[model samples]
Target: MNLGPLEIGLIILAVLLLFGYKKLPDASRSLGRSMRIFKGEMKGMKDDDVRGKEEATTVRGQLAPPAAASPTAGAPDYEAEALAAEARAAEARAAEARARADAARSGVTPADGTR
Candidate 1:
């Protein structure tokens, strides 16, 4: 399957005889252009696939609230949910800090939960 120097030289000679040196540059340039176009199209297809997936995710997120909610109400408010989650996390952190401080003052090891 591997071409040695002799095989490569023979192939080159055949090409030069068939197309001539004058046309070789033009043929190579056209081949290069075709390859570039093919590569560009492949890249474009991949980008389109990624874009399609993102759009589907967005559409699903938009549609999910109405399906999950009762018919009487509108879509769920995700922003408020996110904000409430953040607030809960902040409160937990504050509570942990207070516990550590309390343990330090009472001479308790926080890890052992002793006073």
Candidate 2:
């Protein structure tokens, strides 16, 4: 399995004949450009992956430690907090409605309650 220099030359000649010298230059230029773009894209993807991992690590580090804020016997219930928020929102709406009705009865024109 030894291909001598002459055989290699013949192979090159055959390839040159199959694709003319003019076309070969254009093809080689396009191939080089394609390879360059592929290499650049791969580098960009690797950099993005590294950046993403670093960002994840930074976010993880920024978090409060588990021991610092563990649930205790006196912790407030989330459900109760949510219900309280809802109640406050309802009260605000009711207050607004009452104020609008009072303004309408008094025939007072506020900035936004013309309707």
Candidate 3:
């Protein structure tokens, strides 16, 4: 249903009469305050989630063993190289999982391997 200016004015008049002019300002102010508080809380939660993800990413980066962390001075360290590759694959899987989780949180259904 669409309301023109006349209908809107009538609704406003009814609300003013029901709520009283003096109480309306206080009610509106409280509503604005509540909205601001809600927005602040949502922002804090988003920031915290982002910060947690950053920390997790750092931890994932650090998961490589000491040997796998860098090139060795001795003959080719095959084992360490393998570990490094495994760690990288694991991190990639984790990143995909994180992406899926983020999509889920945002109410977007993640697409499977199929079209």
Candidate 4:
């Protein structure tokens, strides 16, 4: 059914009357938001359908993600690396503390390196 200008005007008039001028802006904003949400959902469904068609050849259970492409992707010792880095940082801090103590005993600031 074709909605002419008259039909559109009647619909607008009805809506305006149903929701008074004070509430018209809020009602229109909600209507616009709902329409936008509906549109996004429809687009998502279409994208999902396209994705399904693209992966139709692969079985759901047997599908494995593609192997890592980077050279270091297989180095799985992350915790060891983190621990080693933490140890190095601790050693540096210890050295700095010792320097500060020696400077304090000699009545010099380690930062100035002067007597």
TM-score for each predicted model, relative to the true structure: 0.52, 0.48, 0.50, 0.40
lDDT by residue (1-115, candidate 2, tens digit) is 9999999999999989999887997777557655654565567558656755554334435632244456668864444544565566557656755665576456575567333
Give the TM-score comparing model 3 with the true structure, all chains together: 0.50
Please tell me which model should have the higher lDDT, number 2 or number 3.
3
Cα error, candidate 3, residue 102 (Å):
34
Which ranges of candidate 1 are over 4 A from the true structure? 60-115
Cand. 4 TM to true fold:
0.40
What's the number of clashes in each of the models?
0, 0, 0, 0
Relative to the true structure, how large is the alpha-carbon lDDT of every model?
A: 0.63, 0.61, 0.62, 0.59
Q: Give per-residue CA lDDT, model 3, range 13-107, as digits (tens).
A: 99999999999987886576556545655675586567555544444365433443776577555555555755665576567656654764465
Better of 1 and 4 by TM-score: 1
What is the Cα-based lDDT of residue 72 in candidate 1? 42
lDDT of 4 by residue, 55-79 (tens): 4433344443334534366754434
Best by TM-score: 1
Error of 1 at 1 (Å): 1.7
